[model samples]
Target: MTTIPVIDFQLHAVGKEGCVELDNLGSEMCQALEGIGFCYLKNHGISEEIINEAFRSSKDFFSQPVNEKEKFARSHNYNFGWVGLEVEKLNPERPVGDYKEAWNITLEDHSLEWPSEKVPNFKPSMQKLYEMCTDLSKRIFDVISVGLKLDVMNCEDQYVPATPIPGTIVVNIGDLMQRWTADKLKATKHRVLNPSNEQQRRQNRQSMAFFVHPDDKLMIECLDKSNKYEPISSIDYLNSRFKATY
Candidate 1:
């Protein structure tokens, strides 16, 4: 089994061309992402305090009664609010929908329906973590560019779960990225299953996933010069997928 690679993302030192560290980091990141579409990044600059507080906020919001959480329910036209459990079935063939709930956050604060009245810290805590994740993503994109020598910038069945490591964040490529890369990078299928351990099943799992999509108006075309897939706008592609799952 190819275990997920753990990369030391020293963003501060990766810019210099021909540096041994940069080459190695670039090589490792690209290889891991290509092989499994996933890697764990260590030495990433985000502080643990911010991460912990965000988790606390997520837990607080989820702990509320269903009726209460429904107050901030997601709107039909946008994916910027609370999504109840079982409302999403990523795998259509599965007997039941996913056993999880999620609150999709966007950069537009006014567009999101915040649970401020109940969880006062939700907005600030999540927003802080969101910005940090965005910054880290841009840095990772830089590393990928160096790895690919690009002049311009951008599996569930039998799936293996990434083993958690302290002080590391997990990164994975999405379908748009794979399409944009013309399959040079894998968009391996993935799904979260219920924990097997009886004791662990009773516990709540709090996670923050930052979905990075290009601007709605931006076009996504094959960057590797392979016309394997047709070009599509970010909004159109995202809407197609969301319509299927939501």
Candidate 2:
């Protein structure tokens, strides 16, 4: 397996570093996105306590009986809320759904419903983590945009492995981003695996993802640097992708 490149978030954080550091990190990000489409982010200022709390809450939420989870089933054709295993087939080439349970949250144009009554402090923890991750995402993009000379970068996002690697955030490019950039950045393919052993199966995987979807009506097009594809609405693009995957 190829090791994903890890990028230091502080290099681009305000006043934390200088242009040389930012440009270097940007170059690394550019290559990583174009090549692997996935990277590990660290030192982006999300506290250890917050990550732990989020994970704990997520595990607790997923641990609940299926009925409790179903209450927050996704609605409005939006992808936020609880998604059970065998529901999302990330890779059309694959014959099975991803072997993990997930909860998705989006900052704008919200449709997220939570089982807050059952999971104490769930809302607060998720909100804080979402804010921090979005902050990190935007700054990281700012660095990449500056380096690539794009006006701005989109904020779509996802989660990574569950291991307690200190200060680690897994960031991957989505299909919409791939479309927007005309494949300048690839949409990484990732999945949670079926447990191979009793010990592995005991650890039911749960993840929280912050997807930064652009407004539904906004036109998504290849950047000016590369007009390889025509413009399409973000919603239409997402619908086509999800319809095929689901």
Candidate 3:
């Protein structure tokens, strides 16, 4: 029964009090990712209010009729938009596709597509959350860079998953990071399972995720230079995965 580590992000966000513990914080985070490929971050700087608002907005969006959601249906060319239920097969070997639906918000400079007429706050709340997450990710990368003593920056495990802890952010390492680190870190296979109880099964589960990817044109190579994986462009890698998913 191994448990995912819970790292207090306040240690990194704090000023004078956190200076001495920064290295230890990075080490703890690295260990968690290297060992389990996931960790829960507590006391992250993002406001709880923002997180709640985003979820509320997401729920509202999902509650709309399928027709309305289809107006912004995602395209293979543009990855940001409404993604209907069962549209993805994260685990290719699974008999069926994923059961969840999603709405992707773009990180590009283009105008966002939102059902503002229906859920007015959806745009603002999600935008704010996106910005906060972007900042937090940069900080996390900085810590990892120092911890690994590198000059450049870079699981479904068993049936058990990290239990939900209030005010904590669950960070999962992705394929890119695993390759970038030359297997120093892990990118685990995971899937969302249905609730065990009938009561819970009837309710909709709301979750939010912020994916951080390097520029589309950026080339990704193995950081350790061991050639464990071949170098590829960000967009090319994403396209290949999307092909398998859709």
**Tens-digit lDDT track of model 1 for 153-245:** 223246786867988899999989988987777788877767899999999887778888999999898887667789899999999998889
Q: Name the regions of candidate 2 deviating beyond 4 angstroms.
A: 14-21, 108-113, 149-164
The worst-scoring run of ten residues by lDDT in candidate 3 lies at: 148-157
Report the lDDT tens digits of candidate 3 across residue range 91-172: 8788887888998877662675778899999888888888888889888887777676333222334744667899999998
- Per-residue error for 150 in candidate 2, Å, reads 10
* Number of clashing pairs per prediction, in order: 2, 0, 0
Candidate 2 pairs with clashing backbones: none
Question: Whole-model lDDT, candidate 3?
Answer: 0.80
Query: What lDDT score is found at residue 159 in candidate 2?
Result: 42
List model 2 lDDT by residue over 1-246, tens digit each. Answer: 146777777666523544455677788888777766787787777778988898888778888998889898766566678778788778777789866677767654243557778898787888878877777767877777865644333323554453435567777888788878777777766665666898888865655566767788999878864677888898888788778767
Residue 123 CA displacement from its true place in model 3, Å: 0.6
Candidate ranking under lDDT, highest first, comes to 1, 3, 2
Candidate 1 residue runs with Cα over 4 Å from true position: 13-21, 149-158
Between prediction 1 and prediction 3, which has the larger TM-score?
3
Q: Give per-model TM-scores.
A: 0.89, 0.81, 0.90
